[model samples]
Target: MNFGDRVKEVHREILSTPHGDLPQEFVTEAVWRGEAAYFLGWAIQLFDKPHPSTFTDPGALTGVLQLLQPDANELVPSARLRAHPEIDDYSALCLLIRHLLQLQEMQAGGRDSLERAYQSRLAKLGLSPASNRLEPGAADAVISSTAKDSRGLYVVRSLAAEWLLGEEE
Candidate 1:
């Protein structure tokens, strides 16, 4: 399969499972809660999938976009996405990766621009970090799982960021 086709293939696989296939149970639970549907759609975007979704869900798109951030540099493509955009909407991936990076920033330190964007989206979702309902110390229960999975979430999100945000202008 081609790069885009590979991405779409994974997207279908990930979306097939209602609970997702994350490592930890909590992380899987969180993904099932919303992140899976959300992030899967994000992956589809990078694949250039047409008509991702129009559901009234909030975090759905953000999670996907967060994963889709094409977060790799010039060297490699993020696992979530096959190849970084060479043609259209470079900034689109950047914008998405920035959010995932914010999750890492929150995990590593505290607040920053990424956090601001995450907060904005969280606000739209009617969720809050203050809630502290999920695991991994952040409202985003998936973030910790992403960090936990070296070849899984962490690698994928990093790739998305590097591929998207770290790409040269």
Candidate 2:
């Protein structure tokens, strides 16, 4: 079924169990759990069959990424990260997804890697980590650093700087 139908199904299931009959804490936990599950399912579907628009339009891709962020952020609490012992790999996942999309658009004999594409794009826009000059490997370094952690990935500070500088315009 489509996303709307799935959302409606979840809503029906949640409402079917009367909230008043459950403890307040239990109800809250259940709702959050259900929402997380729904978002996870949706994200899986997107990864399995990514819409064409997501690849063609930057805004659409951004929206899909944004939709997944809330669930990803809430799914694992920071305190529990120590007990469960998992690193936040969301940035790596996003980079992989973006690379997959870019690869799909490349010619069969194209030799460019995703890193190359990122570097080329940044160079074409004259964006460096410091914004003053493009050192030989600066783009690669910046993108690599950003992909290494969630904090760098979340705001995409360098990418935002490029956009604010009107490079895309």
Candidate 1 lDDT tens digits, 64-107: 34433433121134444433342123223223333654565475
In candidate 2, which residue ranges exceed 4 Å CA deviation?
A: 1-112, 128-149, 152-155
Residue 17, candidate 2: how far off, in angstroms?
Answer: 31
Query: Residue-wise lDDT of candidate 2 within 3-69, one digit each (tens)?
Result: 3334455444544454447556455444434333332333334322222111122233334433333
Clashing pairs in 2: none
Candidate number with greatest TM-score: 1
Q: Against the hidden reference, what TM-scores do the models get?
A: 0.23, 0.22
Alpha-carbon local distance difference test for all models: 0.38, 0.37
